[model samples]
Target: MADELKRRAVHASGAGLVALYLLAAQFDLGLTWDRFQLLMGLLAVGTIALEFLRLYVGLELSLYDSLTREYEQNQFAGYGYYMLSMTVAVLFFEPRVALPAMLMLAIGDPISGTVSDDSLKFVKGPRVLVTMFVVSALIAAPFLHETPLAVVAAAIGATVADGVKLRIGDYIVDDNLTIPIYAGLLATLVLEFGPV
Candidate 1:
């Protein structure tokens, strides 16, 4: 439980990136969207490099033992996927869709993780799914209030991403990669097509 709590703590810390992005934008701190996207892209590249070193070059880091799950030992860790997803969201989606989508992964996923039973494997329980949806909806509401349909769509996307564990061959698709991407795509669709 202590270890899980520590993981959750680190998971929740991803929210700081969103906060920093928002604050920088609001205050005109010189971190524009293009710059932010570039930074995220660099981070994604760095993580990929690290994963390559760890998986193929036989580089071992102590932090991996502590921060990564058993399933991640032989594969890319969640942090890499998290960075990749955030980069994808920011680069491909508008701020209105991307910000809340990032928040859904950063804030909503950690909260859902806290209530989830990892031992269940593959899929989280119904309660965890509901919690994910509600939290994701709340996180998105202030940003997407004018488009209620977008908000709901984002929530549903995040919930589905968080609740299901999809596998392709030997690799399990991490929610860290899916959550923001799914949320952003759904929200963008709603904003584009849903009634104003």
Candidate 2:
């Protein structure tokens, strides 16, 4: 439980990182969308390079836990999945969509995890669902232009994505990858099709 909480704490810290999207959205950062994509691309590449080095060269970093330390064996370490998903979300969605989508995962997932007593049913229980939706809606309201519909969709999507523990052969899909991508796509769809 302590390890899970520690991981969730690290996960929640991504909210601060997602806040930077606001600067780009408002054009305060002087970053064009293309430049933003380039930057994210660079960051993704750098992350992969470092991971490769760490896995192949036995670069032992104290920051990463045994989960990532065993990256040579585990192709999809949590941090790698995190960077990959974040980069994909940024590149795939517009800033408006990406910001709230990322926030849903960043803020809501940890909250859901923290509140759930049962690890197996974490985001699946009814109480956790309500809490996830309310917390996600509140956090996303200020940022999402299509507040009501998009927030609701994002909240639900993030919850579902977080609940998923899909495995493909040896690798398990991380929620860090699932949450933002799933929520972002759902939010985008809702914003496009659902009534405001």
Candidate 3:
């Protein structure tokens, strides 16, 4: 069950990614579209093939599905997805060492939730998010150099993306595309265009 569950999520994520690929083509017209096929191949062959083999080994694939269902019910599945995505990204492609950037989001989420809910009223909502963002920046400063500015930019971008994604997905959209596109664009801008 677990293996099957993992395969389902992986397939869904792959399909979502393929949609993103098509959308991305709109941004860059006249590009030689060769690599897109490669991506599709990886999704259809690599990710699914490895998982299918798990069933032959007598491993319980249903458990993955069960856990994913549980996580969806509990509303904390984002953490698992994050971990899985990062691990796969690192192991498979080695692109976007954006852990520091994403950790800002992960850490800021709980902080924002706490203050926004008044559970930690001693600290203001915006302030707490900012402070967490700042601390994450400080921790990443040595490596990123322009840490403070980068963190602030990412926080603002993430906030806007989150809000916009919800509204956009609410009408004629799949919600799954939000975070990957969010992270992808943010990574591109920060790593490729940002002054830092």
Candidate 4:
């Protein structure tokens, strides 16, 4: 339980990036969207470099033992995928679409994790899926209120990402990577083509 809490804490810390992105803009800190995307890209690059060192160069860090799951020992960790997804979100989507998606990963995922059972399976339980949908919808509401359909779609996308574990050959796709991208893509599609 303590370890789970620690993992969730680290997961929730991703919200700090959202806070910084919003606060910097509100306070005129000159961290514009382009600059923020660049920053995320740099983070993704750094994460990839670290993952290469860990996977190929046989580098071992204590942080990995504490935070990563057993399955992640040989592959890229969730944090790497997380940074990559976040960078892709900001770079490809508008703020109205991206911010809510990011929040769904940062806040909604942690909440879902807390409510989930400790099963190392491919799919979460129905209760956890419901919780993820509700939380993700609420998180996206304020940002996507003008387009309620988009909000619903985003929530559904986020829920699906959290509920199911996708595998590409031997690698299990992390929700950390899928949640924001799915939500952002769904929201963007609705905003672009759906009736607002």
Deviation of model 3 at 76, angstroms:
10
Off by over 4 Å in 2: 1-6, 24-27, 66-73, 121-123, 145-147, 169-171
Give the per-residue lDDT digits (tens) of candidate 3, residues 41-156: 45445434434444344344554453344424323344344444433332332122344334434443333334344352323355554654455445345434544455455445
Local accuracy of candidate 2 as per-residue lDDT tens digits, 28-103: 7777777777877887798788788776877767666633524335464776777778788889987777777777
Please list the residue runs of candidate 1 whose C-alpha ends up more than 4 Å from where it truly belongs after superposition. Answer: none
Candidate 3: residue pairs that collide = 1-61, 1-62, 1-63, 2-61, 2-62, 2-63, 2-64, 3-61, 4-61, 5-65
Q: Please list the C-alpha lDDT of all candidates, in the order they appear.
A: 0.89, 0.72, 0.42, 0.89
Runs in model 3 deviating more than 4 A are: 1-71, 74-77, 84-97, 118-132, 146-149, 161-165, 169-184
Task: Give the number of colliding residue pairs in candidate 1.
Answer: 0
Question: Largest TM-score belongs to which candidate?
Answer: 4
Per-prediction TM-score = 0.93, 0.81, 0.40, 0.93
Measured with C-alpha atoms, the lDDT of residue 5 in candidate 3 is 41
Q: After superposition, how far is residue 100 of candidate 4 from its true place, in Å?
A: 1.4
How well is each residue in 40-61 modelled by candidate 1, as lDDT tens digits?
A: 8888899899899989999989
Model 1 C-alpha RMSD to native = 1.5
A best-first ranking of the candidates according to their TM-score comes to 4, 1, 2, 3
Tens digit of per-residue lDDT, candidate 4, span 1-196? 6777787888788888889999999999999998988888888899899899999999888887666877788878887888788888999999888888888998899899888886977889999999999999999999999899999999999999999988999877888999999999999999999984
